[model samples]
Target: MGAVSEPLIQWFELNRRLLPFRQEPSAYHIWVSEIMLQQTRVSAALPYYERFVAELPDPAALAACDPDKLRKLWQGLGYYSRVANMQKAAQIVCRQYGGQLPADYAALRALPGIGDYTAGAIASIAFGIPAPAVDGNVLRVFARLDNSSADITKPAAKREFTARVLEEMPKERPGPYNEALMELGALVCLPNGAPKCEVCPLAAQCKGRAAGRAEQLPVKTAKPEKTLVPVTAALITGPQGVLLQRRPSKGLLAGLWQPFAFEGTAMTQPELDAALRTIGLCVQWQAPLQSTRHVFTHRIWQISGFCGTAAGPAPEGCVWASRAELNGEYAVPSAFAGIMRQWRPE
Candidate 1:
């Protein structure tokens, strides 16, 4: 035990939020929660996490779930690849580990999408192993504690932070200790704005606080600017419903449904009609819908499109979906949420 361990764990026990995953610290639950929380806030991810666990309770269940259903389950949660990798890992777990996540840290790391931080979390929290689950929160905490101005985005910084976390980890109660560190960072040592050091258990020991640089300790490299991609979609409608096309099996928003779209910002009515003609549908152009933008990790989609009625057979790569079908069957990503809202059946 170290100087910070006992007080931090004590603070965690008294102040930790009553999360679903914490109530049931199973390996599967931990894995799902950790992955979902990677880029999402706890409040935003709660309903999704609950719904997901209720539907696919175990590794075997997740492995055998329908791909479309899987996409639907993870619809609003962006980064579809994370869920995809999770399914792959579930399949492997079913084949090799008999449907239960492996207890060993190395084995968990070997699974798809499970990195060092995730592996450590599952190992320590779910399996009671003495491993350091150093994530962004923990890194920030460590940087402030040591008052070191290291670029936490680098691999070397992560390694150093992990080692420091391990040194302070209480072996007998590693789960609570690790969770405590994470909780402290989330609740008190916040990333944005001023950290609430007054209430933080480690405030006394935080060197950054003493040096009046707690908010500036965990430096990070600036990310490159997101590329802007202009898209023109056709919300062609008819007696059936809305026209939705399936994106390619691989790439951004892979295997998801969206409106038939082109790669340019502005498309004239004649050009759109011609484009629809090439796809075997003659659409009577109505009016342009409100344009919107969706931001991805590396790019932003500046989307603009038109809604029209098409009285013809469905095109080869497209399907006409009734509002019910759209709601019940297809997994449409949120990138086209603006267009869908305007053109979907009332």
Candidate 2:
């Protein structure tokens, strides 16, 4: 251990949060938490983590879980693909490694959804193996400490930072050192503006602070702007229940359920009537509900909604889910939350 790693490890011992997984550390717990935390915050992931672990306690349970039920468990988390890949990896674990996540970093990396950062996290944090988990938080911390103007989004910058982390990481206390770096970045060395250097453990040794560039050291390429996609979602209600349709099995929000939706902005009366006829629903449109928006990674759903009564059998490739089923069983994504709020069943 050198100047950076040793002090960071000491600081981590005193300031690490009492997270659920850290309480009773295990490879499975760490692996699951790491996957959930990707592109998600700790506060947001907490309840999901508790619920997920309680429901799918081990690899065997995860491997044997019904795919729909699994999707239900992961509802509202977004990035549904992660959970799907996790299931596939769980099945592999049960067959290949006796229902336990592999201890070796390389083996963990080979699993679906487990990348180099996640593998290193599980290996060092859960198994006490000497590996470095360099995430965005760690990247920010190191960039400030070294005052490097490298574009952190590039692979070459990440590799260089990873090498630095490994070189300075303590062989005996890699876990604490890694955790401390992440914690410091998240709490003290925040990304938005000036870092709280007064409370930072590395204040005295930070090159970015010395150069008055702590907030500007870690440069990154800007991402493309999200495209707006106009959509009109319908709340087609009947005596049995509200009609919901299952999305196709291979794209955004795959295998999830949503209300009957049509592309384009708010539909004309003729357009709405035609849409209802296609679904075997013949009825007058009720009051117009509020329009809302749901943002995805690269697309935005500008949703307009209407409540209408339908008198017909459920259409093929769809289900007329009762209010009870919708409340207790169905896992509608948050994209339709606004429509659900304004829905008035007639």
Candidate 3:
């Protein structure tokens, strides 16, 4: 271990969030929480984490969960593939490892969606192995601490940073050491030109802080432009309720339930009715709702919303969900939040 280990771990012990998963640091709990935390805030993931763990408490249970139900459980959380890959990994764990996530980093990394960072997090945090978990937060903190000018997006930079973290990681307390580094990054060493260096325990030793270049230390390649995709969400309501379509089993938003939606261009009234006709039903045009946007990693959905009435049997693989069903049974993604708000299902 190096000079940063003691103070860093001490700071984390004093200041870490009182999160539910941290209370019982088991392998399953850590695995699920870590996956949920990816590209998601801790506050946002709490309820979903609680619900998911309550329902699918272990690898075997997750392995045996129905696909639709699993999608529903992960409804609001975007990056649906994370949960899908988790299921695949869970199945592997159940079949091969007797429902236990392997303590070894290599074995854990081989699982679906288990990359180096995730594997290190699980191995160290859950199993007390000496490993380095370097995510964006860690990268920023490390860059500032060492004043490294490396481009953080490159694989070589990550490897070098991982090695540096390993140099400072306490062998006898790898879990807390890794957690401390992550906590410090998230809370004190913030990104986007807002690091709280005054309260940071590592401030005294931080090279970038001394050099007055903390924000500029971690260089990254420019992100690709997000293509704007116009889309329509049809809130077709009738005696039964609103029409919801099951997304295809594979692709963007795969296996999720959504209102009748068309991607590409916002549909005209005639086109909407034609769309309904193709599905063997016709809807009387009501009123167009407001437009909104849902941004993803590489794309932005410029959503045009509408509310209307329809009659007759649902198209194949679609369901007419009542307000109650929408609230209780269906797990609609947050992308449809704007249109659904117009319906006010709650």
Q: Each prediction's TM-score against the native?
A: 0.97, 0.96, 0.97
Off by over 4 Å in 3: 344-346
User: What are the per-residue Cα lDDT tens digits for candidate 2 across 58-100?
Assistant: 9899999998889888888889999999999999999999999
Q: How many backbone clashes does candidate 2 have?
A: 0
lDDT of each: 0.91, 0.87, 0.89
lDDT pick, better of 1 and 3: 1
Clashing pairs in 3: none
lDDT of 1: 0.91
Best by TM-score, which number? 1
The worst-scoring run of ten residues by lDDT in candidate 2 lies at: 337-346
Looking at model 1, residue 180 earns an lDDT score of: 93
**What RMSD does each model have against the real structure?**
1.2, 1.5, 1.5
TM-score of candidate 1 versus the correct structure, residues matched by position: 0.97
**Comparison by TM-score, 1 against 3, better one:** 1
Ranking by TM-score: 1, 3, 2
